[model samples]
Target: MDEMQLRSKIILTDRFDETFEQLKERFSEALFYHISADDFLVEHAKEVVDRAYLTSDREKVIVLSAKRFTPIAQNKLLKILEEPPSKTHFILMTSTKAGLLTTIRSRLPVVDMTSSKEEIQLTINLETLDLAQLFSFLQANRRIDAKEAALLTEALAKEAMRSGKYRLDEALLETFAESIRLLDMGSPPHFVLTRLCLKLLERKI
Candidate 1:
């Protein structure tokens, strides 16, 4: 592995397989061990740690891709990430950074691989969000599934920040994070979105 490919890092992308393939191409010569899941749990983390400890003279890359990573799983992997085995590198790929714990994020550099084209186009203007607009937006997206809802939630949060129209204190920021979690846990998309928008409306500057 070269200088750029030596360290463990997080790759943020909605297209996990595509990004994983790109990483494989980048490190063609290295031995690749991929562990992909919709949700990375503690068992998966144990498998990764086990793979990391395996004796290997050549470069070994463990690619762990998931839609969401549980806090317990992330906590389990922290020690090895901080001090990985010789010639072992980890690449964590996820749809949204909100699902990751700060401790896990602090351990590795995050590279956003998502293109502008992949970002959700927000229909509702968060800056000028009124009750009528909010209700209309909700009605328009009443049938949104969890996956789309997650993307929309992220887009809305970004738009709110970019517009500079909200008093985004830590609590407000945490609401966004919690919204993502609720979506992942199979909460009704419309309900989660409605709650988030109301909170944002209340915090408008």
Candidate 2:
């Protein structure tokens, strides 16, 4: 990677720890500030913004790794991301890109580091999604916890897009992002899954 490539960017990867370690090694010479969390909340976003604003003559890289980023947190950091401080770079590492808001996605270029060969096998096909199938799928995964729910939501979004059978627009994409936010906020996994599937069904082509 060249000096220009080391600038602020979003990195999509399931293996957060490994990807982060590689980045640390790559930016070995620069000052580094890592703020990692299972769920990045508003406070973490504030910390990132604070660290970014600190004057730095040398290259400073702020690595933010999280399984999920709340909408509020992402929004709060939008301004700083759009116009970063001098010699400051940001590397956002996350498990999936579905949860990221369009505003944040637009500000930073995404570098896909995910190497998972396993395809997402969805129980209810988004292309042929119906009420009965949706109910059946929900019932089957009724015991799913929050973390699993987040992963499932990501898979569903991915499968829906890959199927190319839905009228995917910004509104539909935001629903998927909101589903993740709901799950992170302790909402029932089944409920989130139900709402997401229903939204997809509504937009099916």
Candidate 3:
């Protein structure tokens, strides 16, 4: 492919424009489709992928918001992902992977949005959270894949209850799991932390 042709394949979708500009520096050509979720747009968005794929030769890719994925849209994209055109690349980057259709998730090449990562809050008190507990914390407070995070968090919470150091309320355990799932979906850290702390404190011996 010629240099201009190569540049048109990359479709970057993110609130951060500067990041895309910097990312495009590595490639000579990329087709930029700037879109947002509107009632009319979502219904019409599938064409964007189709046109972008057909019109350009560099590669076929879709960058979409995790919270915005729909089953129909994903299934449509999954076809392209499953049987990629030769010399085509499909990269999907999302802050949360939980919303993606399982089929689409399985088919596409998932890449991290390195530009979107938030720095770990320096104020996170680590003195009390050992390795084992910290792992449980991440599992509980997942900002992606909250269902799995809830399961992991419950398992660890159960373990703590079983050890006899704390009381176990099954209902509260489930509630805590739900809170963790919400936190994964983009709740503020303070609210999540507060909910978690109250839950843990309730079971205190």
Question: Stretches of candidate 2 above 4 Å error?
Answer: 1-4, 123-133, 136-151, 159-192, 199-205
Better of 2 and 3 by lDDT: 2
**Ten contiguous residues minimizing lDDT sum, candidate 2:** 116-125
Q: Residue 13's C-alpha lDDT in candidate 1? A: 84
Residue 123, candidate 1: alpha-carbon lDDT: 88
Q: Mind giving the per-residue lDDT tens digits that candidate 3 earns over 18-73?
A: 44454456443554443434111235447645654565665443333332444455
What does the lDDT come to for candidate 1?
0.83
The Cα local distance difference test for each model comes to: 0.83, 0.83, 0.46
Q: Comparing 1 and 3 by lDDT, which wins?
A: 1
- Clashes within 3 Å, all models in order: 0, 0, 5
| Residue 89 displacement (Å), model 2 | 0.9
Report the number of the highest-TM-score candidate: 2
TM-score of each: 0.69, 0.73, 0.42
- lDDT tens per residue, model 1, 1-205: 2324546888878787887777778778899999999878899999999999999888999999987787778889999999999899998988667656667878898887776655678888877889999899999999999878888988887787679898866567667777887887899999998899899999998
Cand. 2 TM to true fold: 0.73
lDDT of the structure predicted as candidate 2: 0.83
